[model samples]
Target: MNFYAIKAIYLFEMSRTFRTITQSLLAPVISTILYFVVFGSAIGSKIQTIEGISYGVFIVPGLVMLSVLMQSITNASFAIYFPKFIGTINELLSAPVSTLDIIIGYIGAAATKSFSIGILILLTAHLFVPLNIIHPFYMISFLLLTCFTFCLFGFIIGLWAKNFEQLNLVPMLIITPLVFLGGSFYSISMLPLFWQKLSMFNPVVYLISGFRWTFFNVSDFSFTISLIATISFATLCLIIIFYMFKTSYKIRT
Candidate 1:
């Protein structure tokens, strides 16, 4: 099914990342190390623990999730958006490739980048505190699904964007805030009852909660709910991408 075409696009996108490794990889690594320093060292020493896990270790999942979410969006959005911005998108569109091949190429590369960052952050996290992964299978599952889902979400943003400002809009304004408020740094149970109830409305909460569960076996929501939520979100993204390609949304422009 046009495997060579898909490989060509995928490798090209990946090569761009290597070319910009300092910006694409090192930046996130340095930022995460800073988070580890400030939150894990300074604050963690004062707080001691959350739900019986050391605060440093407890924050690992959230920290990784934060970076994954941001990078997934940033990478995918920029990859597709740059083509649109520079008028190369029309060339790709007219090429002998199916929509699925194009999506697999772009989103696959983006997902791989985000996935690498996730694993990198995980290894970096170990320098600050000893960590335990209670459920390794579930942890990888959550990470894989999260990378793919958010990469697809970023693809949608890339397609819908009309300018650089519009391109950065969702990841900066919407996603980052949702993650902060979504119990990324703290447990929802620490919130008052009202805020706890309200937090459920934020979809990022389930993602962080479920990922956290795999690490320490502690969660704000049921693991089943988190699994279901992630699957549903990915499915929804797939549907929307298909519709956009079918309608040539923004691409025909």
Candidate 2:
């Protein structure tokens, strides 16, 4: 409803992204290139393909997902956390903006950054390996969903965090590890049966698996289950965000 308020917050966050171009964009681009170099050259040699796709190409979806997830969280979390850290959140709170406006502004900007990096990375992947999208619609659907979901999740992290260190905690310690173990570099099928069973417990696996399927029509789990898991997780994040705003959890403190 408050279009101007949303636009102002969105543009402000976008400007901040441009200001930190090196860290926000270039850093992830460089890191993804390194991953391609190391994994594509070294591991890709021993393993030519997984699920009938070349090892280098097979990992592209997962790599993009990994970068997008981390970027979304990092950007959104830092964007809000900085304002809170510097005591400017109160300014926004006092403004004529609804919680919906604020969340949409921040979350939209964060998702845009994350998704932009993801598209760039996808283009960058073409340089290292030939790629194809068997299902463009499915691919974009999953891409948008993942970007929006994680960005919202990151917004929640921003609200819950009390300091810079805490802002970095989940992405560094939890999300990143989940992604690596979630079949970013290799398929879960390559794991031992016991480890395979355990891998099912990791939620990131479903996301990566489902996204990978859109590319090669291959997945570690059922496509339906992956879709369900992703929607379920996003729903949970949305619920938490509503509760946080309604109760003023950490927002008024």
Candidate 3:
């Protein structure tokens, strides 16, 4: 339905990405390489293996997840927030596109960008460390789900934000901290028992754990739990977005 409308919006967003190639794509890739240099060289030397996987290799999934999560949120939030900031959202609102169509256009483009970044980072990882993927199917599944879910969450952020500062608030303050503490650089098992239990409450842990499991069949939580948590979070974001669009929250005004 309204395929043409979706295509126009999608193309517009994609073109903007190309225009900002340095920031949108290259920046994250460069940052990830730095992480490899610092963590893989300095820290990886001290800690040889976590669950029998080399420290450098062990962190690959986490690093990719970190980049993907942040980029997904950044891309989606900015895509819609720019429209709101410049007063062009009203034009899109008046278009014949349904809410789903609009969401698909924006969210799809954002997810695609993040997904491409994920693939690029994975390929880049090979240059630094020898890597192995035990279950490629599950790895791709988790990557796709994470991209779509976070992009949707970012879209919600775009809608709720009234200013630029507010737009950066969640990803920088909340999500970024959660990721670092969520076992991105080390396993939660390395934590003391109490902290290990406490780590369970941080949602990003499950995401990184589940993705790591796909690579080495190792994780802080059960694979089943991780999958459920990922899907549940996605579903929750979808519900909130549906309600927002239906009520015209921050869109109609």
> Relative to the true structure, how large is the alpha-carbon lDDT of every model?
0.93, 0.90, 0.93
The regions of model 1 sitting more than 4 angstroms off are: none
State the weakest 10-residue window (summed lDDT) of model 2: 20-29
Write one digit per residue (lDDT tens) for candidate 2, span 1-253. 8999999999999998898888877887888899898999887889977878899999999999999999889888888889998999999989998878988999999999999999999989889999988888998889988998999899899999988888989999999999999999889999999999999999999999999988988888887898888888888998999899889999986
Model 3 C-alpha lDDT per residue in residues 132-224, reported as the tens digit of each score: 899999999899999999999999999999999999999999999999999999999899999998888999999999999999999989889
Using all chains and alpha carbons, the TM-scores for the candidates as numbered come to: 0.98, 0.97, 0.98
Predicted structure with the largest lDDT when compared to the true one? 3
**Worst ten-residue run, lDDT, model 1?**
20-29
RMSD of 3: 0.9
Task: Give the deviation of candidate 1 from the true structure as CA RMSD.
Answer: 0.9
Model 1 has an lDDT value of 0.93
lDDT score for candidate 2 against the true structure: 0.90
Candidate 2 matches the true fold with a TM-score of 0.97
